[model samples]
Target: MTTMNLPIISSCSVDGCSYNHDHDCHAGAITVTDAAGAACGTYVDASDKGGVDASGRVGACHRSDCTHNDHLECTASGVEVGAGADRADCLTFAPA
Candidate 1:
């Protein structure tokens, strides 16, 4: 079986979301887009945020048909970010 490693959140995309620190994603849950570059409307937060060694990682690609959805984790190689209603960002994006 192909064992793929999950992506880690390095920063947040939402501006002033009370989870971003210098472009670093610190939110417990983050919003991401679909394979068609559309917003998935899924916000995932980390259980442990702003704490001692808090590993803030968001995984919301639960769709089985989704290419990025790898065992409930986003395996998409690269992701884009923007400041609009259609904007989307992946917290678990990694290069194939």
Candidate 2:
């Protein structure tokens, strides 16, 4: 099967998130948007850490209004995650 080249998470500023490490994300893949308005659904604010030792990528995006969204996937080269109105949000999101 062909592998999908998902969008990379260039950076993340949500220090409270369990998956955030040194301003970077470590989840294998992250999901953004839905009812949360480009929010990072993968964000978790627990005292304990989670995820692996690799950079995160965008596995799926539910913001159909976002310019980079295509078929529920993110088409951007990369995305930045940070704290916004929500705990975590996609900084690269742009209205379509």
TM-score to native of every candidate shown: 0.46, 0.90
lDDT of 2: 0.85
Residue 28 C-alpha lDDT in model 1: 44
TM-score of candidate 2 on Cα atoms, chains taken together: 0.90
Q: lDDT per residue, candidate 2, 1-96, as tens digits?
A: 112488889999998888888888989899886756588988888878888887889988899999898888888999999867687899899988
For candidate 1, report its TM-score: 0.46
| Minimal lDDT window, size 10, model 1 | 43-52
Q: Which candidate is the best by lDDT?
A: 2
Write model 1 residue lDDT over 1-96, tens digit each, in one string.
Answer: 222243556544655434545545543444454454334354334333352134344445544455566666665543334334444445334433
